[model samples]
Target: MLTIDNVSLKGINRPRLSNVGLSLDSGKLIGLIGPNGAGKSSLLKAIAGVEAASGKLLWNRQSLSAMNDNERANTLSYMAQDDTPQWDLTIEDIIDIGLLKKRLSRSERQRRVETTSETLNLSEFTGHSIQRLSRGELQRVLLARALVSEPELLLCDEPTNALDIYHQLNVLQLLKKQSEQGRLVMMAIHDIPQAAEYCDELVLLDKGRLVCHGQPFEVLTKENLAATFGIHADWICNKRGVAWQPRPL
Candidate 1:
């Protein structure tokens, strides 16, 4: 389980997050939804140990601050909003680098790379340079890289930003699969319907404060959506009587 205790971030005396507290259990897909500049990305960064903030981030009852760099890196994988690769390296090479400094045999590393590539439908583009790939393809490559490490917790920021509907669903399905397999998957999302469809729990934020944190039906209501997003929408049940679809506000 991941426990965030009164986590707050301040920049030059301004607070980005204010006394935030939340807990995430394994085998759950948690979506963080909020308007622009609501500190969704900041919250993910703090949980991933990539940002300095006050308060406690604990993993399994142990303080995350106590974990060394390698320990933290090994346990959590963070995929940033802008996951573009800067190096002039092939996709295969980029995926291979996710293993860190581990001394795996050449064949073992190749196997892992191949498996990850196949899982994310990047097997054909493994030889292509990252700089040459399109935005959606690049996102998939980065996701493959993150999965190659097989961390206990997966943190993604706006993961579906550049993908079309097909790949968007694909990525969400992948996250759901990982969560079902007992990995904690948390992502900051901008699309309300996507979060409603795929997430097991929703953490709604407004101006760096948590507005609601619960199941999708409980948190993604019309009132909350209007209050946080400043839009009115009708929340309707799907044909199967599960999940929600929001009409224009």
Candidate 2:
């Protein structure tokens, strides 16, 4: 399990995460959802140990603070919201970088990269420079890089931001599959309906505070949506299912 207790960032005047806590187990996909500046990215960074945050983070009974850089790298993989490659490396090379910390035979590393590339539809562009790819392509490549690492805990920030509708669904399905394979996959996402459809759980944050969290049906209440997103849509539940359409203010 991944446990976070009283997690708060210190550098800022106010707490970026407040005294927040969460305990998540493997084989689960958690989606972090909120408006802009809601600390979604900050929370993801804290969980990835990339930001300076005061918290007790434990993964499978091991304290995160006690783990070395390599140890952390071996256990978790983080995908930044802005993952543009500066050096114009090839798709294969960027994917291979995910395994740099791992001790693997050259053939095994190649195998992993190739398999991940195929999974993300990057096989055809394996030798192409990242600079030559479009934004959506780059996003897929970056995700492939993160997925290739095979981390026990995967933290991704707005991973499907630049992708089209099809790719967005594909990525969400992939994350769901990863969790089903006994890995913990948490992503910061903005697409509420997609999150509602796919995530096992949803964590809603606002202004660095954890607003609400639970199953989609329980947490996405009309009042909660109004307070959190100013969404005054009519929420109707029928024999078919629940559905909501936004209304103009």
Q: lDDT for each of the candidates?
A: 0.87, 0.87
Give TM-scores for every candidate, taking all chains together and pairing residue i with residue i: 0.94, 0.94
Q: For residues 1-249, could you state the per-residue lDDT of candidate 1 as single tens digits?
A: 999999998755467798999999999999999989888999998988788989999999988889997888788888888876679999999988788855679899999999989988888886898999999889988888778888899999988889998989899999999999999999999888778888999999888888999999899778998898877776666665344444456
**How many clashes (backbone N, Cα, C below 3 Å) per candidate?**
1, 0
Pairs that clash in candidate 1: 232-249
Stretches of model 2 off by over 4 angstroms after superposition:
11-13, 235-243
Q: What is the lDDT of residue 137 in candidate 2?
A: 95
Candidate 1 segments whose C-alpha is farther than 4 A from its true place:
101-103, 240-249
